[model samples]
Every structure is written in structure tokens, then in C-alpha cells.
Target: MFAIVFILLLFSTGDSILIGKIQNSTIIDVTHISLFNITLNQCICKLITVSGIIPAANYFPGNQSCQLFNFNNNSSLISSNFNTYWIFTNQSSAFITNTSITSTSSPTTSISSSSTTTSTTTSSTTSLSTTSTSTTTSSSTTTTTGCTNLGMFPYQSTYSVGVSPQSVAVVDVNSDNKPDIIVANFGSNTVGVLLNVGNGTFLSQTNYSVGSAPESVAVVDVNSDNKPDIIVANTLSTNVGVLLNTGNGIFRNQTTYAVGTQPWSVTVSDVNNDNKPDIIVANFGSNTVSVLLNAGNGTFLTQTTYTVGTSPMSVAVVDVNSDNKPDIIVANSLSNNVGVLLNTGSGTFLGQVTYITGTNPKSVGIVDVNNDTKPDIIVANYANTISVLLNRGNGTFLNATTYLIGLSPLSVAVVDVNSDNYPDITVANSLSNAVGVLLNT
Candidate 1:
């Protein structure tokens, strides 16, 4: 008796995909013991068994499944002969009767010959399991190795109030190119303004109370005065507080506007096509996204209130559906999904697409992860882990791969810290009281 084995292997990568197969052409005649020259094809390699004496005019048949092994050094999956079999015969009458062969041995073979030529080669190969494992290991190692050992263990400090600061925005306010950080103290009624000293360190200048609670902040040229102004959401107050940057690392006289009940997050953008920037607040308590038009100066006029999902915490602007116009992306905290608001480009809401990430996604940053021109989303999940939603660039997002970093990642900031064009993610974890910075090695 004789047996044959065949195997097929398939894999892919971010840039390229591939598929291939290995087939056994000849079955070894082990009854009388014969050996024959097996013509190897460029794609198929004949595997032979060990401890078997080779006889002339015989071909070895693979008795087991061919294992297609992918080598890391080689760009393609390489197949080797390592399977084996055993043959036996029964002597009955005048001569020996035909006997069945069983695969009792593993096919362990020495290197006889190899087909090094390839018909077609792709620029990349995707071994998703290996790739995923490698990626996960590399990320874990990077998290443990690359972070700046600020060396100072974070000791509990008495903030202005016993509130957990969730978000931090750094913007150059004084025209000095040095960014000033404004921390949104979510648990407390106060917001801390840390003035950047241009040396990576910040000075605690002032901590001011906005409303009942402050959640998010954005610095923009709100009045077209060539100066950046601050817009913060007074969440509990159900309004937005506008603070004008005084050009001296200080903000004075915060103006308030009644927008909605329990506004969770606020962003400044040119939403109404008015050339002047407008304020879009995600009112979580009301399940609406409020659009406040800039009134030429530091004040705003109510434009429209569009309904969204529950607990809309973060809002982002992008050309999501590739309609050439900017669209809105809102991260709903309670719903665990990011709502996509298709911009009608005429100051009206057109449609929406809901996508979920990790648990409690509070903040989102758009960055091109796969060298694609389109931007991908990096979600900072508060309840669970971090996730990277790669943009397929076809009005759809690839399933997010959760990257474990730290406890309760509330904020994420991306920049080319190593001068590479690729952006590195640095997350500010609230509960751990440490920054989890991930460097793309």
C-alpha cells in the first residue's frame, strides 16, 4: 500500500497578499523497494522519508500531510521534506504477498536539492498570526523599554481639587512657539493651566474654575484676531466657557453660553462654512451635538443641534466618507461606539455611521498608520485598553487591534518624537498616574 500527502499555505500583509500549495506527485512503491528520480518543480518540493533504503526505479510517496513552513529570513513560505513512512510484507505461499505500508516514522530528510526560483514575488507577505504575535511582543517590549524613565515615581499631589484630570491640550498661545498645556480636571470644577517653559517642563501658572465641571478644551483663532482662544465645556453647567488668551500665558474673563444639558466635550472648527471657526459640543446628557457659530468675535451664535448617540464624549472632523467635505466623528462613551456624522457641507446633517472600539472610548486621534494618505483612528479607551483602527481608505475602518498599555487611558497624543515621519502614541493614563508612551519601533 502507498499513501500521498499535500499541503497548502496562505498568508498576507498590509501591503501584499499571497497563496500557494504543495502537492505530492509520486507514491513510493515500498512493497518491492524501488527508488526513482523525483522531478521537483519550482513551487513544489518533494519530501522523502529517512531510514529507508532507496532502490532503483522507485518513487517515494509522501504518507503524511506536508507541513509548509514559513521562514522569517525568506520572503516566501518554504517547504521541506520531513515526513516518513514504514513498509512491511507478508510471506504466504510461494513468494511474498503484497503488504500495506503505514506511516510509522516521521519524514526527517537531509537537504538533497532545493528550488530557489520563484515564478512571482510580492513585495510583502502576510502571516497574520505571526505578524500579530510579533507586533504584540514588539509593542510589549517597547512599552517596557522605550518610555522615558522620568525616574520620579508619581506621588500623589494635591491638585486644585480632588478631581481626576482626563484631557490635556498643548497649544502655542503667546506666539512664542512654546505650547501651553490646559488640563481638564473632570472630577473637579477647576482647570489647571500649565505654561510650557520650552524645555519639556511646565510651570503651574494658574488653576481657574470654569463652571460646575470642565471636560474638554480647544485653542483656536476664534475671533479671527490672529490670537488663539480657549473653549472649554462646562459639563455640569450644561454650557461652554470661552477664555481669551491674554498673550502672557494667562486667560482672563471666561464668557459662558448656554448650549445643552451636560455637555461632555467641545471642539472648535469651521462647521458652517463661515471662514470663522465654530464650536461643536457633544452634549452627552442630552444626546445631541450642538453647533455654535462664531459671531465674528469671541462670542458664538447658536446654529443647529443634531441628535447623536448616548454619552457622546469626543468629536473629530474629517473627510470620513470621501465626499471631499469634512465630516464629524463622535466617540460615544456610554454607547461604546464612535458615531460618524456625514457633513452635508452646507451646515446641515446628512447621515451617520456607528462604529465601536474598546470600552469607554473617550478620546480619538487621527493618524496615518499604514503609510496610507488617509488617516486612521487611535482610540484612548478609559475602561479597557487602547485600540488602533486602521483606515482602509475606502470609507471604512479595519477592525481595531487593541494594544494593551496601561490602566484607564483617558487621553492620547501623537507626534514624531524620534523625528521619524511615523507618529508615536503617548497615552496619559488617569488611574495609573503614569504616561504610557508607545514608540513604533
Candidate 2:
């Protein structure tokens, strides 16, 4: 005589793949008893239950009241009031009991003609089971197809800069959605601009003359105009060069402004929150950061110098303290540390605080590397290493984690090259005569 028993098993969705379910069976002794409760409000809850049971056998669903067997026939069958579902994989086929028979029987399982169904049966009996029959649907897995291996920083292609490319900036020129590149050619006394071709490649580079020995470049919209302007630090000329954008990837001739001696890096931001952008240049020769207040017509007033550590080679602007005011961070190469200048909201800076770093820190970039919402600092040390300083959300940083890179890395830029939602590091290796990319893992 055939006996009918009802059992309910909870299956959650996780990393486990659903195989097939068994129905209308008398459950045997459930030795490894565990309880899991789930509300049937949605299909996601059921998927979660199945996910928890993967790589393991047997799961109890519905309050601690339901008992689920491991599909073994060694124990006696019992009657249950709860509804039960059996999920199995090809490896667990040997343990599955016949669906209609209370006794032990070898059953054969096969993939059904329908893509989503699986069939199982014994020589003398046939039983059908369906795994997912709920009205709620779940999204399929999304994969970034055609992506290169996560850790492989394959060399894409490189364009030749003028003589010595000291620093680089990434921005969209010509209103293109892709990021173009600007390189400060120190030996050529000019800056090179490469328009991105929408793919990973760039168009032929166009060179724009600046003052003597341009060492750094920053792109911004300085004149309340939508077009991005270029700012260059002319190291030997001891001044800052501003090239107003005339639209469509074209820039007017350099408009020079006097600052402290030997300005090695340039960055632009609304320093006083006046809605008009201001310029900040790291003056290496004078050991100061020159703040040039913008006049809103692509011109700036005379610079006000703020003393910083020795030989500051790079400067980055960010609201490090979450104070809504833009602050400054400088990489002091000779001092072997980074200096933080807090914005006092009046276009003036408070006394600087120094954070120790590796030898000859050349460049600094801000990015949220850990997805923590706080901006962290990435520094290129001339001593053959790159350092990552995690932000503490209070304008301070935790200890740095350093990674070895090519020899004499002079500059760094962060970009998401693989569309992987993680920022990768690109370094200009001065002595190596090559650009090194560190793929984010």
C-alpha cells in the first residue's frame, strides 16, 4: 500500500545552483536537524533559503516545527503536515529515494526536454518534480563579458609625448564622452593634448606651446564657460600658464600669471566658494603654495603664498574634512611627506599638517579606492613605489599600504579602464621610459 506524507523544506538563494526537487515522499530519519524560518512574502526569501543549503544536504524550512530528511532510506518514514520540497544535484543522485515508493529503489534522473525541467524515475515507477514554480521571477546573473583578466594590466597603446612627459591629466576634450589625455612635456616647453577616439585609442596628439619647461597640467572650466580650460605650471619660467578653451578642442594662447618661483604643479577649484574657480600652484623653488583668486574671465589676481613643506611637486584639491570647503593636499618631494592645508572658507589656508610618506613623493591623486565614500590618497614615490593612504573620513588618513612599481615613478592618474567599478592606477615611469598601469583587483 502507498502512504502519502507532506513535508515543507525551505530553500534559499545564494551561490548554490538549484538541481531538481522531489515530491510526495515519506521522509526518513533527519539526523542533522537544523531549523530555518522564512516568510513567503516574496520569491527572494525562497532564493535566499536555497542559497544557505548549498554544498550541504537537508534543510528545514518553516519555523522549528518542520523536519527535513537527507533522502536516505535507512530510517523509518513519518507523517508530516508541512509541505516539503527536495532539491538535488547530479552528485547527490545516489541518495535520492524513489518519489512514490517508501522502500529503497535505484532511480534514474535525466534532463527534461524543456530547458528548465528535470525528470527522475525508477524502473517500475515514474515521478515528476519541478524546482521553481513561483509567480515571482529573479534576475539572471550579469557578467562583464569580453573583460580582460582582473589583475592583468595589459599595455593598451601609448602615444609619444614631446620630450619628457612629467605629468598627465585625464579629461573629456571637444565635449566627447570619452576621456582625453594631456601631458606636460617638461623638456619640450609645451603641453601635448591627445583626444580620445571613444575606443581605448587616441587621435593624433596636438601640441600647445606654454612657458619654459611646463611640468604639470590641470584641466578645468575657469571662465564660467562650459568649455574646459588648461592650466600648466611652467617650472623654469617660475609662473603659471592659463589656456582658455575656445571650444571644440581648441585653446587660446597661454595667459601667464606670476606666482612663487619654480611652480611645479597646478590645480584648479573654487577655493573661496565664490562660484568663480581659483588656481593653486605648488611652488617648489619657493617652498610655498600660491593661491591665485580667479576674476571669472579666465584671468586671476596676484597669488597669495602659503608656506608648506620643502619642494612640493604636486597638489590636489578635495573636501577632505567633509566641511563642504575645498582643501588642498600637496606631495612634498624633498620633505618626504604630504601636507594638508585646510580651507578656512575665505580663500585662505590654515597652517599645514604633514603626513609622512616614502622618499621623494612625486604625485598625489584622490579616489575612493575601498568604496567607502571617503576619498583616499594615491601617491607615486620616486623611490620606486606607489603608496595608498586610506581616508579616515575626518580629513586624516590611516597608515599607508605601499606597492612596488617601475623605477622613478613621477606621476599618477586614477581611471576605471575595464568598467569594473574599481579605479586603476596609471603611473608615468620617468627613468623606465614606460608607463605602468596597476589594475585594481
Candidate 3:
């Protein structure tokens, strides 16, 4: 019984050459192979095993078998009843194969000789059977290593609230160190409180009845009692509701104070520098921001209305010019811009300076996004984007960078949710019926 083995080396022109072969050798090592020629073409080497004789005559046939073997510098010869042949090529031919021939006691061998006469070369060849295997291993390693730096921010969880949660405020309502959430549920005509139970989770929400169609809620220590109270903007009732914190996650009956028509949002700050917290309301129907001076005992003086852009939907207080006086920033939904009302150290506001933003900007939040020590403005535009305006530190803002958010983003809040020290954004997506959290990179 005779078995035939065939080995084929195919390459593009000038890529590879068959230098020579060593025949009838008992032991073969890396030192026994030599390169005789060189080529300029880039080489690609592949080793494929074909069983039985092939149709081409270039491969040796009849009782000759080729087996895959690796040649290393420290390899030792294994005793076998076979003959070994080694072939060497140039540097471009990095792949090699070894053939073991089994024959009768005496075997006749023939050698085909060809002379180039142009150059003579001498270099050792090492069988690279594992070269292709190592290359594939490296490719797989690179693919997995590249994914480590692509940080992804996925939703942690969503806690269901009342119908149509239009606004949200994060505070410690029960004096717990963990931050709690208060939502103005417009459709339910109530304020919902979700106590934080730690680890980015919330307990079942508790609701308190307020005036009709509560659009916004703010937590503040209104009575100087060291306990945070809840203030709500009742849109349909055209009033502001003040709920005194009665301790232990409970609130007293809401005290309604009449403000401009269709009050949409409320913020608590010391607008007059009287060391007492005052309430500011954004009136959507009247196109004004109403300031209610705190009377120091859970009561507010008569509301004073200031003219702003059309349909003032949200309000924020900050020292826009670094003058130590709190200035007001309003997001005008109908005007498609933000109105900056600089405070004059008294209770009066200067004429409004408007900075254009995305269409139908609904809510605004202030944060130092660029680490420049000046607060920037982030607005949630109902036109399906979030606008970011960098502050120039002198009560004015530059052009906006708009990012596509969830459908119908009605409100936005900035907080560092991932502990990365950078501010992340949370938007109340009214149309999508979900809260969208965008983690800062």
C-alpha cells in the first residue's frame, strides 16, 4: 500500500521562490535550511493540507507524504521510520512545510537543478506553522481591548409617578442624607414625593393634594424652621401653593397666594437680599415673572409682576454678572429665547436682555459645564432638543449647542448621577412617557 502527499506553494509574481531542498536527512533543524534568493514583492503565505494526489504535476507524487511540522532553534529530532526534506526560500516566504517520506530499504532520489546566476544567498529558515495561528490570536485580542474605553451610560431604573409629571426637584425632604425627588404632577393635580432609599433607587411615591394643575415644585426652608417646605406653581388656578413641612415626610395644607395668570414655574431665592427666601413665579399666560416677597412667617406679600418675554414657562435665579445679586433667567416658550433680568441690588429688575435659543424652550438649568467658574444655561426645548449656552460671565450667553433629546422634553434637571464630578442631565420626556438621563463623558 502506497500513500501520496502533495504540497503546493502559490504566490503572485516575484513574491516567492523555491530555493532548494535537502533530501534524505535523518535529523532536520532550523540550522539545516538556507535562503538562496530575494524578491521585492510583499508576500502572503498560507498553508492548506490536501489529502490524496492533486491533478497538478508540480507537486511530488507516489508514496511521498507531507506532514505539518514546526522547526525551532532548540528542537530535537524524533526517531521515525521516514525520510525528511527541508525547503528554504527568501524572507518573503515566511511559511514552511516538512515532508516525511516512507520507502523501501534503498530509495533512489532525483534532484532538479536550476541556476539563476545572479545572486547567491545563505540564511537559516524556521518552520512557521504557528505564524498564522499567532496572527489570528493577536487580532482577537485587539478587538476586545478596544471596547474598554467606550464608556456607555444606560438607564439605571425608572420610578413611576403620577399622571403627567411636568417638573422635578431633588432634595432631602425627610432630613435624610439621601436625596429625594418631588414631582409636580400636572394631570393628577398633586405633588408626588419619592423618597430616596439609597443606591439610585426610590420608594413608592407619596402624594399631597395642591391647587389645580400643579406645573412646578421647589423645596426651600421658607419659615427659617430648618425643615424644607414645598412650593408649587398652580397653572390653572393662577396661584402659588406653599406647603409647610410638618416633619416626617408630611406637609401641611397648601396656602394659596394669587399670582399672575397661568403660573407655570416657581423658584425660591432671596431676590431682595433681605436674608429671607422669596418666591418667583413664571406666568405663562400673562408673559411675566411674579416676585413674592417673603414676610418671614410662611406668608408672602402681594405679588409683584415683571414684564418678560412671551409665555415665560420656567425661571432660575443666579448671579449672572457676578455682582452678588441674584438675577433671574426665564425660558420663554412662545418667544423662543431666554430673558435675562439682572437684579439692581434692590427688588427691582433691569430691562430684560433676551438671548435666542431653540424653538419653544420650556425649562432652564444653570451649571458650570466648562469649569470656567461661570454658570452656563441648559434649556429643554419642546421642539425636540436640549440647548446649551455657554455664559460669557457678564450676564450674556454665546450661541447654543443643541442636542437631540427624547420626544417632547418638557423639563430638565442637572445633577451628578454617576459620581464623576461632572454634571449629568435628566429630562422629563412628556411624550415618550419616560425620563431621559444623559451621562456626561
Cα lDDT tens digits for candidate 1, 1-441:
233233222233332212222232222112222112222221122212212221111122331222222222212222122343222112121221222232322323222232321111112112221111000001111111232322222234333432878566778877778877777787877777777778666665477778877878787878877778878898889889888877676777688888878888888878657788888888989888888878887788864788877888778777756667667778878777777777787766665677778888888887776677887788898975888887777667877888887889887877777767788999989889899888866
TM-score of 3: 0.58
Put down candidate 3 lDDT per residue, 27-52, tens digits, no spaces.
22222111112111100011111222
Model 1 poorest 10 in a row by lDDT: 129-138
Report the C-alpha lDDT of model 2 over 1-441, residue by residue, as the tens digit.
333332334242434433332333323333232222322221222322432332323322212111222332222323322344544433322332332423223323343344333233222222332222111112232222332233322244878889998878899868978888988999999888898888689987899999898988899999988888999999999899999888888788999999888998888899999999899999999999999999878899999999999999889999888888999999999998888898999999998988888899999998988888888889999999999898899889988789998999988999987779999999999999999999988
lDDT for model 2: 0.72
| Stronger candidate by lDDT (1 vs 3) | 3
By lDDT, the best candidate is 2
Reference-based lDDT, each prediction: 0.61, 0.72, 0.70
lDDT, candidate 1, residue 218? 80
